[model samples]
Target: MNIDECESSPCQNDGTCLDKMNAYQCLCHKGVEGAMCEINRNECLSSPCKNNATCIDGYDHFSCVCLPGWEGELCDVNIDECFSHPCQNDATCVDGIDSHRCVCQPGVSGINCQQD
Candidate 1:
């Protein structure tokens, strides 16, 4: 009959019962959610992320963000679609951000110093 007693009563796994003056409320935990916190909530239904970004769900909330080389929800894969040759035949190699530059010798035109 008492709210405190009800809250302590054994309900079910992942179920937290909150007793009120006239009624009771259940705060469901992971893998469980609903009016009484007795139903299971499917995370896939929400499609929380946008632009193909990944959606990582958390307690009572969720997170959506894109990964490197990918910029959409679900983290849809994409192609970098780029190439570079930084090393010269006579000179050394030099790496750069998103691209590479060649250190040509005294008389080199292309990377790897193939031409003069």
Candidate 2:
């Protein structure tokens, strides 16, 4: 009689064990790997976050948490600080990654170039 190799239940992590001639084969479940399905696949292994963002692992996916001055799914976009027209006195509003800068006209001052 042929010995049943799968009788010992060597597979792990809910894997299915199949008996072979003289060995056993383990069919791993989804999101798991290894000879015995002992390793759980890390959802955040690919580093999905961009621009110095944080990556959080989930059931079968990952979340990219944006950092300061960054936004979007992968945190690849820089925040547009000058979109609201913060500058005054006809000053030029320059958008930057961390903050916005106002290019004041001659004799103009203050954070938003409001003074003249």
Best-fitting candidate, scored by TM-score: 2
Evaluate model 1: give its lDDT: 0.59
Provide TM-scores for the models. 0.35, 0.69
Residue 98 accuracy (lDDT) in model 2: 75
lDDT of 2 at 2: 78
Per-residue lDDT of candidate 1, residues 12-97 (tens digit): 54577777776667777876677566565656568966555667765555666775555444555442323343364756665443
lDDT of 2 by residue, 14-95 (tens): 8999988888899997778899998878877888789889898764467898878999989999999998899999999999
* C-alpha lDDT values of all predictions: 0.59, 0.88
72 in model 2: Cα distance from truth in Å? 0.7
Residue 110's lDDT within candidate 1 is 72
Off by over 4 Å in 1: 1-13, 21-23, 48-73, 81-116
